[model samples]
Target: MKILANDGIDPIGKKILEDAGFIVDTVHIPQDELINRLNEYDAVTVRSATKLRQALIDACPNIKVIGRGGVGMDNIDVDYARSKGINVVNTPAASSHSVAELVFAHLLNGVRFLYDSNRKMPVEGNSNFGGLKKAYAAGVELQGKVLGVVGFGRIGRETAKIGLALGMKVIYSDLFEGPISLKLNFTAGVEVEVPVEQVELAEIFKQADFISLHVPFTDKPVIGKEEFDLLKDGVGLVNASRGGVIDELALVEALNSGKVSFAGIDVFDNEPTPRQEILTHPKISLTPHIGAATNEAQERIGEELANLLIEGLKK
Candidate 1:
């Protein structure tokens, strides 16, 4: 069987498929030529860089499976692919821990003003060291704070574990209602299990000192004007999940008005080229959508994608 990894796959995953008697090609095929060449491959894999729509699926007569290396399937028209009997799979669990880590990384940076200090201190620290210290002196501690998790999926649960370990009270809200028993593994191999209860969305807005969004992309923004209005004054917000889930304009206004004290965003509504307003804003902490960029996450994602492709195409 012939397979094409358009955006590229990990070497370990490529070897796995090759060892299983499938010919794997890691090539950069332009979108204009993708439709013409897609018919030659039985399976095609991609990360966020590639888009697989109905037109491309219709042109490809030979493709039986499509694999995504990361959690979100926004790049793929999943309903259209499945309608054509194409098996669509993504490694949801693979990047959970990595994304969870990034949430806290941004959260910590925002609360501590580390991003601002690190950038400004290098050039002017020696001359105005004490002034810089006083500027960031109002940073708060995470130990006794309330962390609100918007979505309680794998990534959300993992983030809650970190919050719990740090002694932060965690409150989560999800569409599905159920008790999730979270097992946290510490650095010294100590493990502790905690049962978390679900709460209303209003409670999360009212009670949390810090809020982290983990919702999937949808037509409407979950954190818009109304939701922002609901949040407590001077609340910290973090978004490391999919873009467009949080309303960018509303957030910017909130930041300016002091409704939102600080924000850390890893994803944006317009990727590769983000809006100038949000990117240039001094109050927000920004990253270039690198939630799943860690080495460990990439390895696990590759293995998981390979397994799914094997099951879907080989079996």
Candidate 2:
């Protein structure tokens, strides 16, 4: 069988599929060319750069499996594809730690105002060293602060483990009703289990000193003006989940009004071209949606995806 890795798979995964008696193509077929050429393959894999919507799914009758290399199938019409007897799968566990670590990368940058300092230091460091030092001297610490995680899935749990290890109290809100246990592992073979209870969404917003969102994409923004209004003054916020999870306009307003002290945004409402306000905000630390872009995460994702496709194609 032939597989088209539309967004390009790791060489490890490509070799795995080939060794398993399947042909793999890593060429990136442009979006316009997919409908014409995709049906030639038995399976297709993608990351965030490609879309497998209903139209493309309907057009490709030969495709047996639709594999997403990472979590979040917002780019793929999963339910619709499944309804058409096509298997839709994603590697939800593969990139959890990488994404979790990126959340902290942004959070740490925000708390210390590194984003602003890095930008201004290159221009004003020599002339205004003392002034810049005074400007950034009010940075706060993350230890002993309340961290609110808005979802409690794999990535969310990983984030909570880090928060606990950092001496931060972690609270979370999820769709599930029960408390969850997280096991923290150390380099010296030591492990500790911590139990955390789920809190109401409003309560998380009100009590948390730092909030990191981990929910999936929704039709509307989860953290809008009303949610922002419920936050503690000078609260730190991080969004590494999906775009539009937090309202960009409301976030800017909050930052400007001091309702939110600083924000770390990895995802944006618009991809490739986020709003100028969000891009230019001095109080916001930004990354171009690279939450799961780590080499380790890609390796895991590739191995997991290859295994899933191998299993799926045999059915």
Candidate 3:
């Protein structure tokens, strides 16, 4: 069988599929060209860049399986494809740790003012060292702070584990109805199970000193003006989840009005071309949707994708 990795796969995964007697092509077919060329392959794998919508799926009848390299299948018409007997799969577990770690990368950057300092230091460090020090002296510690997690799935659990390790209190809100225990592992072969409290969505906004969002994309913004009004003054936020989860306009207002102190944002409402206001915000720490772009995550995504495709296509 032939597979087209439209967004490219790691060499390790490519070799794995090749060794399993499948021809894997890593060439990136342009989105416009895919409707004409994609039918030659039995399976196709993609990351966030590619879209396998209903029209593309219906156009290519030979495609037996559609694999997403990471979590969030918003770009794919999963139900319609499944209804047509196409197996749709994603590597949800592979990027959990990487994305979780990035949440902290932003949180830490926000709390310490590193995002602003990094920009200013190169320009004004030598000129006004004492002045810059006075500017950034109000930073707070993460220890003993309340961390509010809006979703409690695989990535949320990993984020909570890190918060517990840092001596912070972790509270979460999810669709599930009960408290759950998470096991934290250390480098010295030590493991401890900690209990995390489940609270209502409004409770998270009221009590949390720092909030990190880990939910899927919805038709409307989850954190809009009304939701922002419920938050504590000067609360910090991080969004490594999908775009449009937090309303960009409301976030800017919150930051400008001091309702929110700072934000660490990975995804954007307008990807590849976010609004100028979000891009130039002084209180925002930005990354270009690289929550799962780490080398380790990509390798795991590739391996998991290869295995799933083998299982899916072999049948």
Candidate 4:
């Protein structure tokens, strides 16, 4: 069987699939040529960069399976692919830790003003050290604070574990109905099990001191004027999930009104070229969507995708 890793797969994953008697091709095909050559391969794997739309899926009559290296299927037309009996698989667990850590990175960066300090200190350390220190001195502590997790998926669960360890109270709201119980094992051979308390969307909005969004993208943003109004004033927000989940315009308004004290945004509605207002906003902390950019996560994602492809295509 011929498999194409269009956006490039890790060497380890490619070797694993090749050992299983599948011919793996690591070709970076142009978007214009993708549909024309779709029928050439039995399976294709892609990262977030590639877009596997319905037209591409319709053109690929020979495609048996589609593998995603990382989480989030916003780039791919998953429902359309599945409608045509194409198996759409993603390595959701591979990037859980990386994304969870990024949540904390943004949370910590925003609360501590680390991003601003790191930037300004280097340039103005000698001249305005005292001034900068006083400006960023009134930082909030994470301990004893309420952290609201919007989605209780793998990434959200992992983020909650970190929050629990840091002495922050965690409350989550999800589309699914049930109690979530998780057991976390520490490096020293210690395990801590906690039953995560589930709450309503309204409660999360009202109670949380810090809100970190983990839900999927939809036509309407989850965080807007109504949700922001429910939240306590000066609440911090972190969005490492998909873009367009949080309304950027509403967020800017909240920041200006002091409803949202600070925001940490990893994903943007317009990636690579975000709006100038968000980029220049002093209260917003931004990263270029590096949630799953860690080396370990990439390797794990590759291996997981390879296994999924092998299992799926072979059957």
Best by lDDT: 3
10 residues in a row with least lDDT, candidate 2: 175-184
Task: Please give the ranking of all candidate structures by TM-score, highest first, separated by commas.
Answer: 3, 2, 1, 4
TM-score of each: 0.96, 0.98, 0.99, 0.95
Tens-digit lDDT track of model 3 for 16-112: 8999999999989999999999999999999999999989999999999999999999999999999999999999999999999999999999999
Clashes of each: 0, 0, 0, 0
Error of 2 at 144 (Å): 0.2
Per-residue alpha-carbon lDDT of candidate 2 for residues 191-310, written as tens digits (9 for 90 to 100): 998877689999998899999999998888889998899999999999999999999999999999999999999999889799999999999998999999999999999999999999
lDDT of 4 at 82: 90
Residue 197 deviation, candidate 3, in Å? Answer: 0.6
Supply candidate 2's per-residue lDDT for 269. 86
Worst 10 residues of 4 by lDDT: 177-186
Report the Cα lDDT for residue 297, model 1.
91
